[model samples]
Target chain A: MGCEEFELLLNGYIDGELKDPDLKRVEKHLAGCPPCQKLVRDYQRLKEVTAEMKFKNPPQEIWDSYWQRVFHRITRGVGWVFFLVGAVAVAGFAVYEFATDPAVEALQKLIVFAIFVGLGLLLISVIWERVKASKTDKYKEIER
Target chain B: MSLTEKEIVSKCQRGETEYYEQLVNKYKRSAYFYALGMVGSVEDALDLSQEAFIRAYRSIKRFKPQYQFKNWFFRILTNLCISHLRKKRRRRVEVSTEDKEGRTMPLPDDHFNPHLLLERKEIMRQLWKALSELGNKHREIILLRDFQGLSYKQIYEILEIPVGTVMSRLHQARSRLRVKMADFM
Candidate 1:
């Protein structure tokens, strides 16, 4: 194998991921190649140095309250969903009643109807864009 | 007997929400550190990691019992972190200063002499800086392999990439890191 080819496997060799024929081939190349030997040594040192590094620990209180925080968020999320659904339903019924009432002025009803129509169109446009974006998102497949 | 991770997940799926505490406690550190590595801020990391767990809990029903919880949970965390970074990029926010200030070096060992401790601390600081300077993809692979000590297979599972890709990416990442650390080495 050429040096370049061996270089690709160097990491595998260092990481002990190489197997059988590939491992033997790398071993043979490293036996006679001083530069490759130096590369391996340097990579090993890099790994060793990195292995010593650790993130400073956060306080114990973060751990103590982590679950409580998550639970609170989850419950709050559910509560918000219910609240929004109920609010929207009630508002929609109220608007419907006002728009249909005989005593309401025609111009006022038209204006309110137009406002809801505009809002609906805007919501549909946003949802459509989000769907299209999700479909076209290059990172979606890798991330999810 | 203590319940296994799979059992805990199964219970969670069945509506025993309290059982999820085990999972949160088990992975909180890893989740936080991984987010810290990605976003480079303590506050963001804490928020993102906690958000990941909440997201996981809400979607526990979709998680299959056969899959490793760690892999699935990390997939969520990774998405959140990457999205956070992208948004930060769009905003053109400068976070490097905060990153440096927020990170602390490992405490010096009492066993080591003062001079050696100082040298070690300097080396660690340089390494951390070089790591943070790496491109997003490179830094991610390094964080997964070196920082988290995840196996290549586990990384493939979490990243949803081929094992071959994982190996090549890790190699490329380490190579870049090596170049960045050349001055000190």
Candidate 2:
């Protein structure tokens, strides 16, 4: 096998993910190639050292209350959605009333109407752009 | 009989809200630790994992029975961490690892020491610092392969990539790490 082919198999060989024929080919290449042998050795040591490095355990209290926190978050998430929708609806109604009120100057009413329309369009455009990007982003599934 | 993960998900989609907790409890540790490895803080990890769970629960109906729920949930958690990292970097906020009294120490990128279990303290410290410095892709694959001990196939499932991609990515990650640790070697 070429050096490039052997290089591709090196990780799988070290990871024990290479199949028999490929593994034997890599082994034979390693026997004849000093550079490949050194690469494997280095990777093996790197793996051992990294394997030993572990994140410290957080306090047990975190785990104890984890579920509770998640529960509260889920509830609050629903609450926030309703709160936002209500807030937006109320604000939109207020703007609409101001725009239609007879006492308002024509320029002022037009400005309010323009601002509301601009914000609504902006929101839709942003959401549509996001949806389109998500469809095209190959890593979308990785992010779920 | 106890329900499988897929079965629990099916029940969750059917409006059995209580069954969702089973899914949470099943994968919470992995989810939290995975986020912790990515973000390098306990608080962010906790918050992001919980947030991911909420997102997953909200989208449970969209889940396919053919896929493993853990992988699906993990993907959500990973994306949340990536998004969190991007926002934190944009804001230039160090990870808040402060005491209640507000005393803080300066370190690289608000790093938390992961040398608690390693025999080689200096090496582990350098290893972690190098890991924190690596880009998101390299750091992620290193965490999955070396730290989490996930097989290539499992990494493939989580990454939604071909097995060859996993192998190549892992090799590149390890190579970058080796370069980063040249001083130690």
Q: Give all candidate RMSDs, comma-separated.
A: 9.1, 9.4
Q: What does DockQ give for each predicted structure? A: 0.27, 0.31
- Categorize the docking of model 2: acceptable
Q: Which pairs of residues have clashing backbones in candidate 1? A: none
lDDT of 2 by residue, A4-86 (tens): 77887999999999998988888889999998898888899899988887777777998888888888888887899999999
The superposed Cα distance between candidate 2 and the true structure at residue B82, in angstroms, equals 1.3
Model 1: per-residue Cα lDDT over B2-95, one tens digit each: 9999999999999898899999999999999888878777788899999999999999999987779999999899989888877656433322
The worst-scoring run of ten residues by lDDT in candidate 1 chain A lies at A135-144
- Candidate 1: global Cα-lDDT? 0.82
Candidate 1's C-alpha runs over 4 A off are: A92-144, B93-120
lDDT at B124 for candidate 1? 78
A98 in model 2: Cα distance from truth in Å?
17
Global lDDT for candidate 2?
A: 0.82
